[model samples]
Target: MKSPTQIINRELKAKKKCQGNPTKKYFKELIDYYINIKTLNEFCFAFLKIKITAKIAIFYFF
Candidate 1:
């Protein structure tokens, strides 16, 4: 088993190694991806609603 100090030092080193622009760019990309997915979902939902409404209209009319 590792000592507590060894674990702490390792964690600190990892934090220092990762601190900078890479993290920011990753988050920005993540947010952009989320936004794109949300837009696509909304578009699909709208399309489905229109399609269902059309089907209902045709059923009643025919």
Candidate 2:
């Protein structure tokens, strides 16, 4: 979790650079950051596949 002060400072910088409220832009950047982190995406995808596989197995067995 980001510290409040750190989050505030980043929002201030982003807002100044964008010359408006930064929430939307910040989220875009956040998504881009996550995409760039392939390991995290891979972990999430693997977990999701596991969950779906488990559900399918249960559906067929019961």
Cα lDDT of all candidates, in order? 0.48, 0.51
lDDT of 1 at 32: 41
The true-versus-predicted C-alpha distance at residue 2 of model 2, in Å, is 30
Error of 1 at 36 (Å): 15
Over the stretch 6-50, how does candidate 2's per-residue lDDT look in tens digits? 544754565476556344564454344334434665547545644
TM-score for every candidate vs. truth? 0.36, 0.37
The stretch of ten residues in a row with the least summed lDDT in candidate 1 is 26-35
Residue 10 of model 2, lDDT score:
52
List model 1 lDDT by residue over 1-62, tens digit each.
33446534743554465557434443344334334443565546535644564576468656
Give the TM-score (vs. native) of candidate 1.
Answer: 0.36
TM-score of 2: 0.37
Best model per TM-score: 2
Which stretches of model 2 miss by more than 4 angstroms?
A: 1-38
lDDT of 2: 0.51
